[model samples]
Target: MKKIAQFFLKPTVPVVTINGQITEKSVIELEKNLKDIRVSTAKALAVVVNSPGGSPTQSKKMVDLIHNFAHDNHLTVYTFAEDLAASAGFQVLISGDKVFADQQSTLGSIGSITNFMNVKELILNQGIEIRSVTTNPASVTNQSMFKDVPEELRHVYENMLQSQHKKFIDLVEEQRGSKIKVPKEKRGSLLYNGDVFNGKQALEYGLIDSIGRVQDVMKEEFPKADVVFPQKPSISGKFMEYAKLYNLFQTIYQK
Candidate 1:
């Protein structure tokens, strides 16, 4: 009881938590922490994540930062996704020098999704009109899409998603090239069409290095490290809504 009390009273190892949706701001903060030479003091750096994913742009920025930080600081970095880490979140999870996850954790969604609503009819029904000013046909092609979206617009948008998806695939291949193998038939596609998996599947797919809790793994790897929380990812739904709304309007409407 006395030793347990002492353990509670002591400061633990520094474990940075990247636990929410990946956004520009999230990447900014994470990069800031990584840039901190303070990480050099820790025996090993650990990142814990649980997210449904967000912007691909932010995911790439974060993945780059993770790579750069570990290399520059020579700190062994460990990443974890507990419960869930899909889409952009999965990209970040695999960025770890070594990745971990809970046995039942959901992982992977190595694809891009740009969801939108065709509300032009709804607005017209209410007698509301959205006027726009644009310079050219290409410019208006995107902004004029609040209602009936065109096949051309859909095609272009799909191209954009494919472009981003290609990058996602490239990153996975780069990070876990040796550990993962895609059956010949599934090449040029996600591990399973944006479907997430349990830890065992993730490990088999080479999405993670192992399946274990941060505390247990860190205790064994960095016994004397000062475990602390540099920061944590805030789990929320507002960012996902914003991504869809902003991307939809930006790609489909011009004004």
Candidate 2:
């Protein structure tokens, strides 16, 4: 009698969580999981994303990598939003072969942003005088946040933002397969101002396809396939669990 060949199978859908700031590590882990799925006995892939977006560079890299992987493997990639998916998160969604959002899930606000806080007032309140000398006159103004911002740097920043804004619009147009209409006045950096929309509203605005749960879609598409979660114990969850245990230990010691 011939020996039977044992076949191992893997889940097609891998839910990746992007709760906090997106980092290089998050990108690496996502790539690793996708690679594993490619070699495994899985026909397709799905990523359940819940993110507020992060570094623009990292977000772009992640989106490109996912797009390439799906194309090479001929795998259908689906992205299902949970709770929230905005900014860089939206970028990743565009890479999906099919994008979905729940009835209550929030999406949209496709844009880029950078934030900086001025500490000059705090130092001045402390009676601290800070002085700096620069070889270039422009450098002096650039180095200090206390003084009014220089027009040149402001123009440069605005230009960079405008370019990014255009790229975002282009991506949306490509993914949606239609031109999105936005007023000329609202076309700049104000594109993503942390606005959240329900599924119906999102569809009206051409932000997403349909309003349905992930499980329902899976059952309809892959009736016989099993769902899988690639990475376990999200960073935030692990941290909270550890904190709870530590608190328990402290209470016991005090008693």
Candidate 3:
């Protein structure tokens, strides 16, 4: 009876959560979790994402890490977004072989930006004198609040942002491939304009594969397998709770 029951038991699908901001610290924690999951007996992996996005470089690192994990373990990867997945979050979402999101889930925002505030006037008004002893004053002042950004420096920053934006677009094109319904030329204006969308709009724009809740979709897609979270849910739970509190306060303040 024991042998028979054992033989009937199905493999488990391990899940990883990517909630809140994606930073170097968060990616490091993920690396540790993946290292543990690498030795697991599961044949498939799932990622639950709910993030407004952060740190483009770290986001790419996350995508690469997950993709390598799938390759190394020969595991099928499924990604689901519950509330939000924008910008860097969307980058990580593309790592999945199949992506799912709730009907109300927010997705996309394929663009790049860098902001620096100039406080030269403020400091001057405060009667503070600032000096740069460096050989190249531009180097010290380019991004410093103590000095104004030169036109050439502003141009340089613009070019850098454009370059990053192009790379982001290219990544989406490469990953989604034929699944993306948007024409190549029109993608820039339509999909890469830093705008977000709901699941239905995402599907129409070819940003996601489907609109469905995580648990329901998991049951349907992997009926014989039990969904297992490889890491503790406390971290993600805390993040979501904090996010809710912040939003609540914002609403109250606005009202």
Can you write out model 2's per-residue Cα lDDT over 1-255, one digit (the tens) per residue? 011101323235544545555679879877777665522435566777788888778888888877787677667888878888877787777567788888788777676666545688888899988776666645424546665556766666678787887787777767774533455456444344546677677766666766766778877787766666664457796587557656766887899
- Residues 156-185, model 3: lDDT tens digits: 888889999998888888889689988988
How many Å off is the CA of 31 in candidate 2? 1.6
Model 1 residue 115 lDDT? 69
lDDT of 2: 0.67
Per-residue lDDT of candidate 1, residues 23-90 (tens digit): 88898888777654344244567878888898888877887877787777566788988888898888
Name the better of 1 and 3 by lDDT. 3
- Off-target runs (Cα >4 Å) in candidate 1 are 1-13, 35-37, 131-133, 138-141, 187-192, 231-255
Q: CA lDDT, every prediction? A: 0.73, 0.67, 0.81
RMSD of each: 16.2, 12.4, 13.4
TM per prediction: 0.77, 0.74, 0.82
Taking all chains together, the TM-score of candidate 3 against the true structure is: 0.82
Which run of 10 residues does model 3 get worst, by summed lDDT?
1-10
What ranking of all candidate models by TM-score puts the best one first? 3, 1, 2
TM-score of 2: 0.74
Which parts of model 3 have CA positions greater than 4 angstroms off? 1-10, 38-40, 137-142, 231-255
Scored by TM-score, the top model is 3
